[model samples]
Target: MLIIFSIPWLVWRLLKTDYFAPLVVVQIVMGIVLGPGVLGHWFPAYYEFVFTPTVVHSLNGIAWWSVMLFVMIAGVELDLGKAWQHRRESGITAGLALGAPLLLGCGAAAVLLGFDGWMGPKAQTWQFVVGIGMACAVTALPILILLMEKLDILRQPLGQRILRYASLDDIAIWGVLALILMDWSRIGKQLAFLIAFVVLGLAFRRLMAWLDEADRWYVAPIWLALCGLGADWAGLHFMVGAFLAGAIMDGHWFNQEKLDLLRHHVLLVMMPVFFLSTGLRTNWAVGGTEVFAAAALLLVASVAGKLIGVRIAARVLHWAPGEASIIGWLLQTKALIMIIFANILLDKQVITSEAFTALLLMAVASTMLTVPMVEPQMRRSRALAGSAGQST
Candidate 1:
């Protein structure tokens, strides 16, 4: 446990990877480095000794709950009301932002289908294509907020617009996941779960409303656990349930400072375990060259499609020069959320370990590119604004 936490943190600080790769990104990369394909292959005996079945099992438990809590917090941070207020703009941007990449990513998946080891044993062609497509379209909303705050734009007008766009896309991403996970045999159970959720959700809201703020904090996790178990039992997966658990609650109910702290602490203390676990699942049996090639293909599709989509929106909406570039790059940030999305697909056997590894690489590359790409465009925008102000 200490090794898992300390190694990534030490590497992050010592290497000063934060100029492009933040601590979260570093942790994810370290996880991949520590996984079977890399570390285990290099030193099989040591790897086995360190990550024994019992040890791995214990770590898996921690990873699951850590990710569940992080995802739930992401759900709480979503502000659909704000998205609705700027519905026209948000809708158009979100639709295009999600659509173009999904279409292109499906194309990429289709190509991979021509080859072996890309699709999971259990996945139908459509499920594999659509699941991979949606992974390309996801924006890590929590990470976006963090990055924007780092850029000193989180509370700015442009930041708010980006948030609104991401919020809408986040909804679409999860809806598509639920669609992909739909099972005809379990349809009845799924429907029952949804029906129960509606009724229970109403009651949960009422109970939350009546509770003291202090008590509400204590009650939230109990609700989270029940919903997670219910979702998993219904075959939708517990992560979905964790998300739904957070979605129904209003963020305004809690103290903003405390909520932010909660998110930070969760990332700091627990999410490294989740990252490591995610890495351990990556496979290179398809060969490392093949995996890297696949990742490169997905990255191109993801980045290009996002820029194309946003550029179209820019033309349609008459956005300022270079604005689309900034928004497109920022929206393509995909570290945690895409990893989570891929994990679910892997858990359901919709994608093979090779595919998951490729997607993981694509996500890391996408996130690392974000801040560096955006900073220059932002400087240009600021310069333009300043010159305009001076002339005025």
Candidate 2:
């Protein structure tokens, strides 16, 4: 109920600002201060009402819908017309992006092993470690697109190339995570479920098409949202359904403009509550001078890891240095996506509360620090591009 108004307010705010440093950090800092660490002490019951067992369970439901809407808009905004304009290069770039993260993340898990606060306890430690690699391997394309637009590179050749790469990257990450989840070892069962997933996906389209013909666009989100619940019931995690629902809706019939309109509707309306809800989850009491140091370390690691991985991959793929650096800087961006996985781990009891707290702090603080460091270069790049155009 409270989520209804809360998300819209946040969306309104996000619309007015550039996301790099200015937008994401403000939310994280405000979230930290308003978080349970501060608010819990000052008003424990009020905090509880918003983040309580029942409330979070409810927020989980809202978050589930948010995920679907987020992905659906990604699919819709995707220039289906440009699919062939750069298919070969897009494929190679996407492959490089996904493969590097997969190997590096999985390998890096040796140092940060047993860190699946998001993988949950039902899955083994190795699986969680695998999830860690998979988590880092993902590129949140929704956020990436937003960043690209903000940087004003949306029409450049390199921009289009990275956009395609990021889209394909999103698809691969979803598939990899599906493979990395629980009940993974039983090949026969997994195969059956894979087949079933395809069947259900096809059926979802037929059903939605019929409904759309009958003027039922509203039903699409609701139906898709319910499928998330069904996925959870089947132990596949609701996000699996959420992702599948999005990909299913990617066909030609779901009007892109309509979806775009819907995108703002949710973003401006219901999304901020989710952000606030996310803030409410952080515990800032752990703050200290050293905590700041560690926060800085996490921020550096998060950005550096992505920059190095993507930069090397970009060069290998023969991208211009300019494009490579932009991709690096852009991909370095992080969001609540990492925090989501970490909290899942906490809920599954796979990690200690302190570790969960630390990672949550890491995510918020990392995102906060991201903008300040990245913005100057982004502005410079834009300015340079402008000067070069005039000179040429």
User: What do the candidate models score in CA lDDT, each in turn?
Assistant: 0.94, 0.59
lDDT of 1 by residue, 21-83 (tens): 999999999999999999999999999989999989999999999999998998888899998
Identify the candidate with maximal lDDT: 1
lDDT of 1 at 192: 97
Candidate 2: tens digits of C-alpha lDDT, residues 1-392: 54444433365376654443444444544555556767677898987776678876786667656756765556545554465577776766667666665566555444544332333446566765665565555565666665666666767776677777777766776666566555544556556555776887787777766765435477667756666666665556666666666666744666656665777677655555566566666543444443454444444555566677677666666765466666765655556555555555555555444444555565655454444555676678778979989999
The TM-score of candidate 2 is 0.77
Name the regions of candidate 1 deviating beyond 4 angstroms: none
Clashing pairs in 1: none
Candidate 1 lDDT (Cα, 0 to 1): 0.94
